[model samples]
Target chain A: MNKFTEDDLKKELETKEYEYGFYTDIEADKFPIGLNEDVVIAISRKKNEPEWMTEWRLEAFKVWKEMKEPEWANVRYEKPKFQEISYYSAPIQKPKLDSLDQVDPELLKTFEKLGISIDEQKRLSNVAVDIVIDSVSVATTFKKTLNEKGIIFCPISEAIQEHPELVRKHLGTIVPTTDNFYAALNSAVFSDGSFCYIPKGVTCPMELSTYFRINEGGTGQFERTLVIADEGSFVSYLEGCTAPARDENQLHAAVVELIALDNAEIKYSTVQNWFPGDKEGKGGVFNFVTKRGLCEKNAKISWTQVETGSAVTWKYPSCVLKGDNSVGEFYSIAVTNNFQQADTGTKMIHLGKNTKSTIISKGVSAGKSQNSYRGLVQIGPRAHNARNFSQCDSLLMGDQCGAHTFPYIEVKNKSAQIEHEATTSKIGEDQLFYCNQRGIDTEKAIALIVNGFSKEVLNKLPMEFAVEAQKLLEISLEGSVG
Target chain B: MLQVKNLHASINDKEILKGINLEIKAGEVHAIMGPNGSGKSTLSAVIAGKEEYEVTEGSVLLNNEDLEDFAPEERAHKGIFLSFQYPIEIPGVTVTNFIKTAINSTRKAKGLEDLPAKEMLKLIREKADLLEIDRKFLSRSLNEGFSGGEKKRNEIFQMAMLEPKLAILDETDSGLDIDALKVVANGVNKLKSKDNAVLVITHYQRLLDYIVPDFVHVLHNGKIVKSGGKELALELEEKGYDWLK
Candidate 1:
């Protein structure tokens, strides 16, 4: 029996690797590494957008030029040279198809490598996916029924052409252009992403999902996603990201915005698995994203995420409770391994009377990984009877890995009530021995214990997605558990 | 069924059990009573192959086979059981799943076919009812958040399920109330047979009244200082371990 201590956990968490580092050998048309007015105009023209949409992009670009990169996050990185990054790249084999049958076979094979083959047995039957490869929406399934519900689900490019008025109404309503540095960059150059709108009083019957796979080398992906739930409507959305094996680092900067109007409800879930750099820290993905949502009077919005990839990740999905009796929630599990770094958490802004919010964050760090949780809870003067609760827990897989928590809470309304709690623990030898005595092996026991710790947040995901996320957690911690 | 000769052990470089000798035949029951730090539990831990306790100089024999060579699970597969003094909790693994895995692993080690799920379920139900345990308890995580008495009964339940040739109970009666003590004693008595042996290690004589050991040994300073019939337990109860020390 190996006596497990805090130090043993520290040892195992420090040995992470890049198993998905193999890249596809394909030709792609790409722009030069740099950002300028011409690059933005080229993207808008390539998508064949209307005049107003082009103007919107130009306006956002002007705002981005005035913003500075943020340094508030506890992350160490060589600032990415934006001007040296190609902002657009697309597989040359990709065909401009309007239906699933017209989609190219090679594109189908690409989704297979990502383990999501829409044509092969519909492994995710309950899920309707819109695959975004490089800088375009390759294929979208279950479109007709969703369309019948008055639900507008399509690529933002198509939305800009077909529903110009609606896109103009909510494009930057939740997250403005100058929200932050990464968001500003995303707003200025976001090439392709999903746009969904649930019409008033109509509930989306099935889960909506999308998969983002970055394949073009040196191309910085800027995908923008927007989901809006009108009055008395309900919807649940999920997004999963994976990249082909690549030795050279790929940059991914994306933004997501969600809005729930009066008496509406929305649930958003994400599973991020970009390729972390190799054991020697040679190459991987640099993921920087900003996601936010707003809940109106009698509205509710919940965010659940499982982050298990990226050589360096910096994201914080937050919620703004601005209407009376609105509610907000954030449940997240962020695991980083082998030279990976992450600074992620949530924010809850209480501005309306009787508003409520709940946040639960779980972080697992292994193999020289550095994981931090940064959150904010603010209660405004008008937020009478506002309440908030937050619980953050970190599990260290080894001593070399690090975990930290920084929570900011501000109260202005005397009637508001808030509570915060945090705990840090390592998987002990005694705990492992107890499981092994019952015949479970070391790897399985570690998986079970970590699953138990993250159960609260995992249960918030859609049933099918929750199971997949659990498997991802197991696979991500495979050799790290020992 | 079990034997120990010149069994010397230490923990963290400090000697806990000095030279000790003990033996038990099939169908026999032995009770060992001692004061704190007299190596009452050390003998059980050493025999069970807990890695922390070093066998500085010793030999443990089970059914004429050298027991010191096998791992803890190997000893279990060879028909040895140790009811822990304090059972460890394993969250997220149900008791039923754990016991089934244990039984199947033992079978696998013995080169026998694993029991089918149907047959195993039937076997579990019968043993659970005989021990008067709630069926729902089997669905909960193994020993997690269990009361002291519940933990003890769980140990007995596991012992019954395993049906080992040599069952060693280390202070199983310590934390139990009178009612739970009776339940534990009853379960152990039901498991006794002419083909197996039982060794009970305790610090009090109250437990001996129910199990009725054929022999009572007073362990002092890691060695058996006194050995006699069941009447020895009553004498020790009256005078206590001070005289033996």
Candidate 2:
């Protein structure tokens, strides 16, 4: 193990190539590289949206124009120039394909490289995948199979066209057009994302997923995802993202809203692996996302995320418990290395009697990165006997990294119970030596320790995705300690 | 099996082990008894290749090979084991998994394939039975919330599983009730073999009665001042270290 010194670890960590960094060379119909009311209107026109929808976009644009970029997050980077980003870009030759054979071979090859071959996935797993490239969702697999179970799974664009009443009823009910700065921008220029609806008293028979890829160089991916679970229904939705390597930063601002009616349940999971730039922070993605869920009486919602990429990440997946005896949970593991920055957590709002929420967050930072967990828990005046338990733990590797925790708890009802625990610790030398003396090398020791530290949250993930997230954690922290 | 020649070590400019010389052959048990802060633990740590203790002079050799350039893991792979006085608490890794990783890593270092799951389980059960460990105990996180006796016994359980060429027991008898001490001693005695050796470092002669040492050495200050047969431990117990000073 002498050869595996600190310097060697540093070199190995810096040199491990990002596996999903290759770009597909295909002609794309992209908007001009700028943002304005005309650009937003052009996006709406390209989608052939209804006049009401176009008016909604115009209203969101007006609000976004007056909003200032939020600076309170514990991250530092050059503010992205919104005007220099192309808001809409899609593969030029998008023919309506009925089978896998009719899909563009180049596009199919790109998904194959990402290890989600549509053909293979159809035969192997029951997961229905919606493949979104740049600003448009191109293909949705297992739609016929899902339609049999009375579950609506398709791209949000098609949902607007086919189920216009549902889309219009629930479009901005949870996250309004004026929710936040990035959310307003996403509402104005959002092109395409996944939409899922599980009917009352019917549990979806399979997992639903969306894979987002940023294929175009200068385009920003503004995706809007909405999932609605009716009374007594249950559905699990997964989201994943990756991008090609570039020397200039790319922008990605997304909005995700979930609605769980009486006795319904919704599980939302994400494994984000965007490009994290170079060792010197040359180029990567600026990910600013808004995700929130609403749970009605006797309903439940859970948010599980494994964030291992992005140059700068600012996200908070929140839940609003509005009905009596409702439940909400958030389990997350965020890792940042080599000039990466992440400020993420969750918010739990208890509004009714006997509501409950649990928050477990783990952050790992290495190689001059900064990771922070900022959370909020608010109990309303009428929320009698509401309960909340929050635990935030941070692990640091190398002296150059940083970890911070900011938790805000507000209890209005005297009977409400809230417990919060936060701990910050580094990988101790004694622990490393103990592993070393047991014949385990330092690199494997670090991985084992990290995996152990994150097991609680990883256990919350579904089986297949849990394995993938575990591997992602290992790869992200490879050769980070000696 | 192990030899330390004129070992001189220091930490932070303060000398600990001053010209310490010791040797132990296979099939023998040696006890090093000392008062508090008399450099007994320092010698065990230095021999185990801890980096904090700077060796100012002399050398430690295992099977006639110098261990100066070896890292702690390399030394462990070369068949040296030190049962820590206060075992580390790894909160999530179970005892069984920890031992499996240790065994497989050592095998990998020797260019061998991993032991099959069946064989690993069988070995763990056999060794665990010898130590009288509960099946449920083996599934708990390593040393987290463990009693002092359980920590010591767990260390011996690891030693029994690894079956190293040399095992150094550093204050293993501390914090154990009479029954726990007897069980731990019995476990160590059962594991002793003609091809391996044991070096026990303790402050009192209470543990020497159970796993009686063939030789006893008294360490005062930073040097060994007396060496004799097992009866020497009895004499030292009868008259405290004040006379030795």
Candidate 3:
């Protein structure tokens, strides 16, 4: 029998390539490098936005130029050149297609390879997908059901064209342009993203999802997503992203805003799997995103995310609980492997009486990656009898990896209650030997242990995403269990 | 069923099992008692193919085949089960799920389909009842926050579930209470058959009273110095291992 030593496993892990590294060859209508007032005007004009929307973009642009890139996040990388990045890029011949037959065959093939064809999704899973490739919203399925239920689901650009009043009312409400550096940049030059609104006292029938793919190199993807749940309504939204493998570092800065009106609820989920450079950490994506939600009286908002890719990630999805008896929840599982760095968590703000929040964050670091959980729980002075529970756990695979947790809790109310628990653990050899002595191989043992570690956060995911996330965790931690 | 001929094992350049010879046939139960640092646990770990222990000049054979290059899991698939003295606690993995994985993994190695869920649950329930374990304990995380006695019983529970051809109990009765010891001993006894063998490594003669061994060996200084019948256990209990040493 041939002996496979631990050194061989290490070598195998060092050579593992990104799974979704294939690129689409197509012509694109792209903007010239560098950004100015004219570039912002051109982007607004290209989208055929109304005058008020154009002015909003200009205002965001003016503030973005003055706002410096925030360095507070615990991630180190070469800062991307804003001037060298194309502000907007869209695949040509991707205009409004009434049916799949009119769509480009290559685009259809890409979606099929992505395993999320609109037809298959509709017939099998009933998930309506709005796909954005290189900043353009190409195809959105299941509109008839949305229309029947009095729901508004489409691209933000289309929403600006069709429902200007609604867009204007909620575009920059939750995550305003001045919220952060990335939010300002995204608001100014965002190409396109999904926009959804549930009517009052109604529940959206199916899962509304968006798949963002960065196909064009040298183009920064800045997408903006907004969701609004009317009074006594409910909706669940999902967002997933991936980019092709490239030698040059790519940038993805997106802003997402969600609103839950009185007596309404919103559940938002994200599975981010960008191309996280090669084993040597040569070239990958720099992901900076701003996502936040606002809850009205007697409303609820929940955010669940599984982050497994990106060379560097700095994101904090938060919820502002402004309603009495409101609830906020943030459940996240961030897996970093092979030179990946992620500083991701959430914030829950309590401003109303009897509000509650729960935060469960699990981070897994393998190889030479660094994974950190940074969270904040704030209780305002008026928020009497507020409660918050937070648990942050980190699982380290190798000695070369690092995991950190920085939790900030600020309570101004005397009646507020808070609880926080944290634990750090490694995949000890004793545990592996135990599993192996029971007939499980090393790879399967790692998978089992990882699944066990992230069960809490994985259980919060929808059925489809839970399975996918489990597989992703196993893939990310391969061979590093030594 | 098992053989260890001239087995010399060491960890970190220090030889623990200097040179040892052992052989056991089917349907036989052998107990090896020794004082502290007598290489009892090292022998079991080497048999189970733990990566830490290096067998300098040795061969552990299961049946007539040489188990030289098999990984720990392969050794397990070859029917070598080690009831660890300290079983690891893996949080969030339920006891039933852990056993199911272990069994299916072994089956897969043997080119067999996974045990069906219904049958798996049935076997698990039967084994749990045999070990006198509560149903609620089956759903809890494997050994997480479990009492010491519960942990040991859980180890025996796993041994019963796997039903290996050769089971090595490594100090499984150290922390176990009297009742848990009886349950564990009963489980091992029920699992024993004409096709299987057992190796019990303990420091005391208490557990042997419940699960009587056919042979008792005294190990001293990484070597089995004396080999005798079951009466040697009672004699050693009254006298001590100092005479053998």
Runs of candidate 2 exceeding 4 Å displacement? A1-15, A105-109
TM value for model 1: 0.88
Candidates in order, interface RMSD in Å: 7.6, 6.0, 7.2
Q: Rank the candidates by DockQ, best first.
A: 3, 2, 1
TM-score of each: 0.88, 0.94, 0.96
- Name the docking class for model 3: medium
| Ranking 2 against 3 by TM-score, winner | 3
| lDDT by residue for model 3 (A228-294), tens | 9999999989888778899899999999999999999999999888888888988999999999999
lDDT of 2 by residue, B213-242 (tens): 999999988899999999999999999988
For model 3, the stretches where C-alpha displacement exceeds 4 angstroms are: A1-15
lDDT tens readout by residue for model 1, A116-171 = 77865245466778888887887777888898898988888878888888889999
lDDT per residue as tens, model 1, B1-245: 79898999999999988888899999999999889889988898788777778998979999899877776767777887888888977655668867776787677677776687789899999999999999999988878899999999999999899898989999999889999999999999999999999999999999998998998888999899999989999999899889776
Weakest ten-residue segment in model 2 chain A by summed lDDT: A1-10
Clashing pairs in 2: none
The most accurate candidate by DockQ is: 3
